[model samples]
Target chain A: EPEVTQTPSHQVTQMGQEVILRCVPISNHLYFYWYRQILGQKVEFLVSFYNNEISEKSEIFDDQFSVERPDGSNFTLKIRSTKLEDSAMYFCASSQTTEAFFGQGTRLTVV
Target chain B: AQSVTQLDSHVSVSEGTPVLLRCNYSSSYSPSLFWYVQHPNKGLQLLLKYTSAATLVKGINGFEAEFKKSETSFHLTKPSAHMSDAAEYFCVVINSGGSNYKLTFGKGTLLTVNP
Candidate 1:
């Protein structure tokens, strides 16, 4: 079956550096989302994108976080000046309707 | 707003025993509920989902869930547990009435299948 794919299964970055986590959603899906799970914490929604624009975002999604669908297939999440708390497993998901399919996830580690 | 509450943070069951993971949901509109499983070092996999279709929804791996509107609950159950079934399970909810289908996940229930 076609599944969402994320790049760089794991990443390590400096505390103040920027990191871009990339995802290629299922080709025909229209909605995309980013969510993160801190160690031993609930998976929290960051933002949702549709029509190449942010449809909604959570409080955790601030100025430091941005999402872009730069191309037809690539959806990327950029974090400017990553913080230690930014370390987590970030998941990319896409859905044509109510049921969304998730990617393997990118483990971002900021030291 | 929608939220999912997984009653147990952890559950231990012996192999071949029945498995039950409890979940409750709160939503303003009618809700679409889902159960997802995450094995270590793997991505989240959809086990099953309950849209407004049948109250009893069956999923992969011999798992099933019943959507009880009166109780506002969608709990996952299996006839028998296997070692491979040991994983973190999340109950998820999304508003069925809205266009933006942002999934809200529960804290997760860690299932440990003992031999």
Candidate 2:
């Protein structure tokens, strides 16, 4: 079955640096989303993208976060200034219909 | 707003025994419910989903869930647990008609199946 794919399975970055996480959603999917899970915490929604625009975002998605569909297949999340609290497992998901599929996730570590 | 509650934080069962993971949900409207499994260090995998179709939904790897609207529950079950069934299970709910499809996930339940 086709699945969402993300690049850089794990990343280590210095605090205050910028980081961009990339995802290639299923080719036919129209809706894309980003979620994050702090270690030992529940997964929380970040933002949702559709038609090259943000549909909705949670409070957790603040000024430092931005998402882009730069190409037909690539969706990216950029954090302007990373912080220690930003370290978490970031998941990219896509849905053509109701059932959504998630990528393996990119583990971001800030020091 | 919709929410899901996983009753058990952890469950342990023998390989050959039946397995049950309890879940309860609250929704103001008809909801779409789902069960997802995550092996350690892996991404979320959809086990099954209830979209107001058949209440008894059968999913991959012998796992199934029954949606009980009156009880506001969607509990996952497996007749015979396998050692490979050990993983973290999350119950998710979403408003069916809402424009925002943000899913509310339960904290999750860790299932451990022993030999």
Candidate 3:
């Protein structure tokens, strides 16, 4: 079973520093997404990407957040300046059709 | 808009007992509902999904969910529980015909299976 894979299972960054979370979605999938879960909060959608551009984004996806499909296989989320609140488990997902497949997730910690 | 509500934050059951995790959904369009399980320190794993085709959806690990449109509910159930079934379960909803394609997840229900 092909699965979406994320890089750097865990990351620690200083507040105000940049962090890039990488993900390699299943090769044939057309849609990609980024979501995050705070320690005691629900998993919230950040953004969705298709056709190499952002299709939609939630209110939580502010200017500090950006997503890119740099290549055919790599999808990356870049946070220009991290804040303490940005520390959470960030998940990468992809879907060819209805069902979205999720990656193991990258735990981002900002101190 | 799409949203999911998991009724119980935590549920306890003994091994071999039945399990029920309640879920309710609200959607502006036709919905695709799913149940995902996340073991501690593990990624979210899809258990089952209910699209327009079937109301009773069966998934891995002997889990199944029935979609009740009139009730706006898609509840997960299992005939028997096992120790391995202890985990955090999330009920998710997505707008089937919408262009965004982002999933809205519930707070999650933590199932505790005791010996």
Candidate 4:
């Protein structure tokens, strides 16, 4: 079955540096989303993208966060200035409708 | 607002035994419920979903979930447990009438199957 794919399975970056996490959702999917899970915490929604625009975002998705569909296949999440609390497993998910499929996730570590 | 509650943090059962993972949800409208499994180092996999079509929904790997609107529950069950069934299970809820289809996930319940 076709699945969502993400790049840079693990990343380590400085606290103040900018980082971008990339995802290639299923080819035919129209809606894309980003979610994060702190270690030992429930997965939290970050943002949802559709038609090259953000549909909704949570408080965690503040000024530092932005999402882009730069190409037909790539969805990227950019963090302008990373904070220590931003370290978590970031997941990219896509769906044709309400049932979303998730990628393996990118583990972001800030120091 | 919609939320899901997984009753157990951890459940242990021997192989070949019946397995039950309890879940309860709160929704103001008709809800879309789902059960997802996450194996170690892997992404979340959808087990089954209830979209108000049927109350008893069957999914892959001999897994099934019952949607009880009166009880506000969608509990996952399997007749026989396997060693491969060990993983973290999450119950998710989504409000179809909402503007966005953001899912609210439960904290998760860890299941361990022994030989």
Q: Which candidate number has the best DockQ?
A: 1
DockQ of each: 0.87, 0.72, 0.81, 0.73
Model no. 3, DockQ: 0.81
Q: Whole-model Cα lDDT per candidate?
A: 0.95, 0.93, 0.93, 0.93
List the lowest-lDDT window of 10 residues for candidate 4 chain B: B94-103
Q: Which lDDT value does model 4 have at A29?
A: 92
lDDT tens digits, residue span B1-115, model 3: 6888999999999999999999999976668999999999889999999888889999999999999999999999999999999999999998544455778899999999999
lDDT of 1 by residue, B6-115 (tens): 99999999999999999999987778999999999999999999889999999999999999999999999999999999999999998533446999999999999999
Error of 1 at A34 (Å): 0.3
Q: Which ranges in model 3 have alpha carbons more than 4 Å from their true place?
A: B96-98
**Collision pairs in model 3:** none
Best by TM-score: 1
Q: List the candidates' TM-scores in order.
A: 0.98, 0.97, 0.97, 0.97
What TM-score does candidate 1 get on C-alpha atoms?
A: 0.98
Total clashes for model 1: 0
Weakest ten-residue segment in model 3 chain B by summed lDDT: B94-103
Cand 4, B chain, TM: 0.96
| Candidate 1 lDDT score at position B108 | 98
Model 2 agreement with the true structure over A10-88: per-residue lDDT tens digits: 9999999999999999999888899999999888989988878998899999999999999899999999889999999
Which tens-of-lDDT digit does each residue in A24-106 have in candidate 1? 99999999999999999999999998887988899999999999999899999999999999999999999999889999999
